[model samples]
Target: MEPVPLAVGLAALLGLSSAVLEVHVGQTSVVSIKGQQAILPLWYTSYSNSRPFVSCLLERRDPTKHLQVLTYIDGKSKVDEKYFKHRVGFLYPMPSPNVSIAINNTQEDDSGQYMCTVNLGDESSTDGRNIGLVNLTVLVPPSSPTCKIQGTPHVGGNVTMSCKSLSGKPSPMYHWRRTGPSFQVFFAPVQDLSKGTLTLTNLTTDMSGTYICNASNSAGYSNCTITLEVTPAFNAAVVAGAVVGALIGLGLILLFALQMFVYRRKKKDVQEEMANEIKEDAVAPKTLSWAKSPGSDVVSKNGTLSSMNTAQDHKLYPSKPPSDTASVTTATGSMVAYKPPYNNPRGGTLTPTPSLSSQSLPLYFPPTVNGIHCHHANVPVHRNAQHRTNGAQPQAPRQEHTLPPGLTSSTLTRMGAVPVMVPAQSQAGSLV
Candidate 1:
C-alpha cells in the first residue's frame, strides 16, 4: 500500500472507529511544567468476554523517534525498559479495564504525541487495534514589560506609546493607562490601537501625568509606568495675575471662616450665662409675706396675721349680702353698706379713740360704708359672763353688736373672718 499520512495511517492500522472496540484520548494537547507529572488521558472498550490487551506509545517527529512505553497482556505487564523504565505506567491497571497512563517527572524532551491502543485476542491484531492520541506542552511566565513614548510629549502634540514583554509561552495582552493621584487609573485617549502600541492624538494639558502599561497572560502579568510632562508656553503677566487672584481668594476665605468661628463662640458664651442665671433663680429661697394671697403677685409686710376664735367667747353676726339687700340693715333699724378699705381716703389707717381697757391697746375699724363695718371686732371674754363668783374680779358687761333680722350664722362664717385681738383672761388664747 502507498504510505499514508501519519495520523490517517495510525487510525487505519488500529481500526480506532471499529464497532467491536473503541479508544479515547485528549483531543487537544495537555500542558505541564518540567519536572512535573503529565497525564496522557486514555480509555477503551472491548466487546470480548475476556479482558483485552492494552498499550501506550510516544511519537516525536523532530527527533524521528517512536517508543512503546506501556503494555499489558495475559495478566502481566511487558513494558519497554529502554524508553520508559519506571517513568510510565497504567493509571488504572488490568482486570479493572482502564488504559490511561502517567508520565512521571516530565521534561522538555517529553513533549510529543502520545498514542494508546487496545487489542482483542483472535479478533484483533497488533496492526488492527483501537487507538487514541494526546499532546502536551510546558509553559513559562513572561518577563517585566518595557514601556516607552516615541514622540515629544507636549500640549496639543501627538504621541505614540509602546509596551512589550519577553519570553512567555502563549503571548501576553497589553493595556495602556494613566496613573493619577490616590493611585487611580484611567485609560489613555486612543487614536489607534495595535498589538503592543497605543497612539494618542491632540494631547491636552490635563493629559500630562504618569502613564502605565500592563501585559498579562494565563502564566503571569507585568507592568511599567512613565511620567509624562506637558509644558506649554504662557504669558508672564497672565500667570502673575492668576496667582495674585488665587492668593486674594484664599485670604478672603480664611477671614470669613475666622469671623464665623468668633460669632459661634460668643453665642455659646451667652447661652451659658443665661443658663447660669436660670439656675440661680431656681435655687434661691423665696421671701414669705403674711398678707400675700394665693396666686397674687402683690408684696406685703412679712409678719404673721392674727385670726379670731369664734368658739371661745365672741359671737359673729353677719350682715345681709349684696344680693339680699341694697345695704346692711342692723338690729337698730339702720342700713349700712360695707366696702373695701383700700379705696378709702383715709388710707385704711387706724387712729386710737378712748381707751377700751387698762391695756391701752388701740382698736381700729376697717373702711365702712354707712356705719356697717367691713370687719368684726373680737369681744372680750370678761364681758357677758356671770358676775365674778367667789371673789373673781367683777366681770365686764358684754357689748352687743346685733345682726340683721334675716341673716343666718352660716352666712356669717362663709363671708370670712377678720384678724382680731383677744382678752387676757381667755384660756383659748388668740388665733394666728
Candidate 2:
C-alpha cells in the first residue's frame, strides 16, 4: 500500500511536467501559387534544461497516409532525401526553438496537411501537448479556353455555344455574352456556369453577332470569342413550285421524243407500201397479132381456106398496134406485114427472122393465122430471084396441099373456111 501511493504520486508529477512543453503552428491554412514558395511557421516551449528533438511530417487526409518530411536531433538536421530532398528546408538553423520550414518551387501535388512534433530528450513521456498541424494549398490559374458553336444558327432553330479550358487548379466557372452589330453587350438567357455552355432558342437575324465566353477560378480567368449568323427560313411554296415546273418540262421533252420516233416509223412504212405498188404496176401484159397479107388466103394442112382481112385481123386481135412494121414477100408472091426487131416488155429482144433469100423459106412463121398449121416445102422463090436478076415479072410458085381425110377444098370454100382461133402463147414475145 505504501509503494502504490508513491507510484501514483510520481505519475501525477510527470503529467504536470509534460503539460508545460508544447508545439505551436499557425492555425490558418496557407495558400500558394504554382512555381512559387510557401512557408510553414512552427515554434515550441520547453521547461526542460536540455534541447528537444523535433520532427516534421506530411499527412494526406484523403488517402490517410503519413510521410516523413524531416527530423532534427541534437544540433544536426536530416531531410527525407527521397520525398523532400532539396525542395524543403528549415527556415531556422538546428538547436533553435523555431522549426519553421520553407518549400521551394511548389506544385499542386505538394498541397496537403503537415504536422510538427517536439519531444524532450530521453523523456519517453506520453502525457504532453507537443504536436501541431498545418494545411497548405497550391492554386493554378485557368489556361486559355476554346470557344465553339454547335447546331445550326438559323432562324426558328436552336443552337449551343460552348467554352472549355484545358487546365485549371480548381474547376473554372463560365459566363457567356454577345456583342451586337452596334457593339451592344448582353448576357445570354439560358446558360450553365459550371458546364460552360450557352443555349439560344428560336434564333433570329438580330441574334447574329460576336459571342464571348469567360472561364474563371480563384487564381485567375481566361476568355474566348466566336461568331454566330442566323438567316431567314426557306419558303415552302416556292420550292414546291420549282420542283413541279422542272418535272413538267421533263415530261414534255419525253413526249416530244416519243412522238418523233412514232412519226418516223409511220413514214417509213408508207414509203415501203408505195414502192411495192409501183413494182406491181410496172408489169404489163403482152399481145400477139396476125399480120395481114393482101390478095392472098391462108390454107391449112386440112385443105381449109382462112382469108384474114385487115378489118377481121383488128377485130380478132383488139390489142394495141405494134410500134414498128416491116413488109415481107412470101414464096406465094404476097406481101405480108410483120413487126420488126423490138425489145420485149419483160426482157430480151424479139426473135428476128433470118435474111430472106430464094434458097430457103421460114420453117415456122410467127403469129400463125387461125390455128392453121401450114407447111411449105423449101422451094426457092423464083419470082424474088428473077426480079433481083433482071427486073422482069416472075411467075408465082404453085401451091401443093395434103387434104384432110374428111374435107375437100371445094367444100371448105363453100362453107367460108372454118376461122381458126389461134390463142396467144403464154410466154412474152415468143416465136412458134
Best by lDDT: 2
Q: How high is each candidate's TM-score?
A: 0.37, 0.49
Error of 2 at 94 (Å): 2.5
Q: What is the lDDT of residue 395 in candidate 2?
A: 30
Q: For model 2, name the residue pairs that clash.
A: 370-420
Question: Candidate 2 regions off by >4 Å?
Answer: 1-19, 47-51, 62-65, 81-83, 122-128, 179-189, 232-432
Model 2, residue 100: what's the lDDT? 79
Residue-wise C-alpha lDDT for candidate 2, range 215-306, written one tens digit per residue: 99988899999989886667444677889999999999999999999999999999999999999889784322322222124332221211
Clashing pairs in 1: 14-129, 384-398
**Candidates' lDDT values, in order?**
0.56, 0.63
Q: Once model 1 is optimally superposed onto the true structure by TM-score, how far is the C-alpha of residue 34 displaced, in angstroms? A: 8.5
Best by TM-score: 2
